[model samples]
Target: MMQENMAGAHLIWMLILALVVVIPFWRICQKAGYPGILGLLSIVPIANIALIYFLAFARWPAHKSVQQDPSS
Candidate 1:
């Protein structure tokens, strides 16, 4: 029983560790123009696993059209 509890605790810690590394990096990706929820897709199987890799290393969209200032 004690060993099982320890194993559960270790699993939780590993998940927390992954989230700690992913969340802020995800936010940065969002600010750089990717959708923020793209991080959540990282949890999906197969295709999403690839998506995560792509998002992690992919170039964020930096040149999308933006509204111009009327004062310009």
Candidate 2:
């Protein structure tokens, strides 16, 4: 049925959209020394906003390591 095909197409489109949004955030989390799994939160409505604040205010492990280095 056309409706069945549309549903499948919708699911695929949403998955692609999620990946487009998540992959960059996932990479950012990794680079910031946070768990990349945190990027999965991007798909959640309220949690996504909270995640942004969490990322912005949270102390990054990468920065801590750099600050602790004697060469710096």
Candidate 3:
């Protein structure tokens, strides 16, 4: 049926959109020294917001220029 074909097309477009959005986030997480899989957390409502806060506050391992004092 034409409706079924349209539904399939819509689903495919949505999946493509999700991939387009998620891939960059995944790469950003990886660059930030967090697991790329964490980007998938964006699919969750509350957790995604939490993830943003976590990434904002957490120390990134990739940024080696900022050395920490061990004596503290």
- Top candidate (TM-score): 2
Q: Candidates' TM-scores? A: 0.54, 0.95, 0.76
Better of 1 and 3 by TM-score: 3
Residue pairs with backbone overlap in model 1:
none
lDDT by residue for model 1 (1-72), tens: 999999999999989977875687578658768777776665556756776678667765743423343453
- Please tell me which predicted candidate would have the highest lDDT against the true structure: 2
For residues 1-71, write the lDDT of model 2, one tens digit per residue. Answer: 99999999999999999999999889989999999999999999999999899889999999999999998
lDDT: worst 10-residue window of model 3: 63-72
Alpha carbon deviation, residue 15, candidate 1 (Å): 1.7
Q: Model 3 off-target regions past 4 Å?
A: 64-72
Which residue pairs in candidate 2 have backbone atoms (N, alpha carbon, C) closer than 3 angstroms, thus clashing? none
Rate residue 14 of model 1 by lDDT.
83
The sequence of per-residue lDDT tens digits that candidate 3 reaches over residues 1-72 is 999999999999988987887788798899988799998877678987998898888888776434554544
Each candidate's clash count: 0, 0, 0
Score residue 51 of candidate 2 by CA lDDT.
Answer: 87
Q: Global CA lDDT of candidate 3, please?
A: 0.83
